[model samples]
Target: MASKVIHAIYTDDDILLQAVKQVRAGRYHIAEIYTPFPVHGLDKAMGLEPTRLAITSFLYGLVGLAVAIVMMNYMMIEDWPQDIGGKPSFSFLSNLPAFVPIIFELTVFFAAHLMVITFYMRSKLWPFKEAENPDVRTTDDHFLMEIDVEDHDVNQLSKFLYDTGALEINLIDNK
Candidate 1:
């Protein structure tokens, strides 16, 4: 299958931002955009939903904490029952001070590692993956917005994009 896309190029982030807003306001569906750097408010302008990574991190931390508690209790109380610091109570909660460091370290370690893994998976990134950037200039000084020409007149859309401050525009077919 083949599809047509319009690549509207911009020299300024502000101009690209305004073009995106205007294009969206006119009920046009933008397929994607590429920029040299992160543009503030771009996600909000694109109406993307908020991510739930914070919640996932919290859960991962809990899992880490639980593992810490279980491992510490089994080792210190149930298995060996050490008498460190002359406090031989032989109880898990009684010796909690000795396990605090492990608990904290494990919690942070699990949350950070799992969050990174989740981000990579969600973004479809992995080792040995080929780059998908369409234009090398987008990584330098240009911003490119890709719009699908599904049912609209290409001439009208290209003119509208030009009016929105696009420095250059090109039509490409993708399969």
Candidate 2:
């Protein structure tokens, strides 16, 4: 089976944003967007829900904190008790102050690394994955908006996008 879509190209982000809003106003469906850089409010304009990556990051940080605390307790207090200066303390609770730096570092490390991995996976950006962008110009200065062609007249949709200031329009067929 083959599916057809319309690709509208815009030279400016502002124009693309406006075109998106107008398309949605007309109750048209936008399949995807490709841009060289992030456009502020584009997601909201596209009617996308807020991301939950921040919540996941906080949970990952908590896991890192727990791992750091347990590792420190086992290594410092139980595994190899060290005696420095005049005091020899072998209790994790009593030596928690000294482990603050390690805990903080581990928490940050886990959160940042795991967040990147989660984003990549969620976006289906696997190693050696083929690119999905229909046009290479979108990676440079152009912005491309993909509009679904379901239950809509192609000529009318292309005409609408042209009126909305699309620099170029293309019909793509996917198998």
By lDDT, the best candidate is 2
Model 1 whole-model lDDT (C-alpha atoms) = 0.91
Count of backbone collisions within predicted model 2: 0
Scanning candidate 2 in windows of ten residues, the lowest lDDT window is: 84-93
How high is each candidate's TM-score? 0.94, 0.96
lDDT tens digits by residue: candidate 2, 68-129: 99999889888888886644566788888888999999999999999999999999999999
**Candidate with the greatest TM-score versus the true structure:** 2
Count of clashes, each model: 0, 0
Candidate 1: regions farther than 4 A off: none
Pairs that collide in candidate 2 are none
Reference-based lDDT, each prediction: 0.91, 0.93
